[model samples]
Target chain A: MNFFGIPDIYLVILGLLFLSIIMAIIRVIKGPTAPDRIVGLDTINTIVIVSMIIFGLAAGSVIYVDVAIVYAFLSFISTLFIAKYLEGGEF
Target chain B: MLNQLIDIVIYILLAIGVFFNILAGIGLLRFPDVYTRLHAGTKCTTFGSIFLCGSVILYGLRMWILGNVDGSIWVIHTGIALVAILLTNPTGAHALARAAHRSGVKPVGAVIDELENKPTKKSANKMEAKK
Candidate 1:
């Protein structure tokens, strides 16, 4: 009933998260504009952070949640940088 | 009995979070143009993350009340992560929206844009070049 020591409910939640990530990736692939793709990327980043937290809970570890925190900030910075680049302005 | 109640609450929170996330994904696919997609992608995910992280925090609190020291760490770190998400999600969305507008992506079916004639730094430069 346990896969990699994760309970069934947590596994289900993770699977659903994966599905949502796939959907976001689809948008990324099909988007016509750069900003659209960036939007999809942002969504994926947030979902990935949530999934990491769930995995941390399932595995009874704290490190994954900590990593998720770092990932969130890094992704936010990257999003802003990309936005600035799209704006085509200095810095 | 109390443990069961706590578990039920956690499951409810998780379900709510997952539902909103799925809705966000669907919205991203279904919405037209950049602004609407950004609307879907940003607000839904931020709301979902709140509930998801809330569940984890609740679970950690439950464990702590049961005398487990590790639960404190879980609660603290997850809370930090939640705060990080809360702080960054909207700011990033706003930046993206502004960038989209500045880069000339217009909203679908809009009759007028109020910011079009507004004098931003870039627009000022354009005006100077025209003169």
Candidate 2:
């Protein structure tokens, strides 16, 4: 089956990903401690990267997957820096 | 016939990946403490991304064999992305766990606190500064 010329399965998978993202967002908002929020943020980043790849495939474009690669590295760096800041020690 | 079989395999991979990704989200919400939540968030997503990216790579490979040059690019780049995810996810989780512990987010209901008694470098440094 297809919707608007895109395969329906792709749309279903994307919707599920969105649901997971929303769940992570809830955790970020409700988390009591700083680390809890950071964990939620990390989950969100990974999910977004996966969805970006799926979107790239569905759209028949290589650029999105390339962007996802760049995003993966940047997010990893950010997560590390945030952890360092929370540790309250010299970098 | 072979093309249809490949399509089926791709679908299965996508399904498995999405299920695990959703599980990660549920785990994040349900787990009580930061450590447990990180366990859920980091590991599940990493596993899920593996399958998800694997499916994409497989699709690209099929396309490349079918005379599409872009498929080769897709496969190579997706493989790199998967590697980046695999390398970085666990490292980031380790950092987050260490930071959480150092920042005093203790695990819930723990009997033995081995690391608690141990003097970390940060504390040793503080002692030096005070002298």
Best by TM-score: 1
Docking class of 1: high
Task: Encode model 1's per-residue lDDT on B1-131: one tens digit a residue.
Answer: 99999999999999999999999999999999999998899899999999999999999999998999989999999999999999999999999999999998989988888987777788799889999
Report the C-alpha lDDT of model 1 over A31-74, residue by residue, as the tens digit: 99999999999999999999999999989889999899999999
For residues B1-131, write the lDDT of model 2, one tens digit per residue: 99999999999999999999999999999988998998899889999999999999999999999998888998999999999999999999999999999999889987787888888897888899999
lDDT for model 2 comes to 0.94
Q: Can you give the lDDT of residue B57 in candidate 2?
A: 95
Q: How much of the real interface does each model capture, measured as fnat?
A: 0.92, 0.94
For each candidate, what TM-score against the reference? Answer: 0.96, 0.95
lDDT of 2 by residue, A1-90 (tens): 666676788999999999999999999999999999999999999999999999998888889998999999999999999999999867
Runs in model 1 with CA error above 4 Å? B129-131
Q: Candidate 1 chain A: worst 10 consecutive residues by lDDT?
A: A1-10
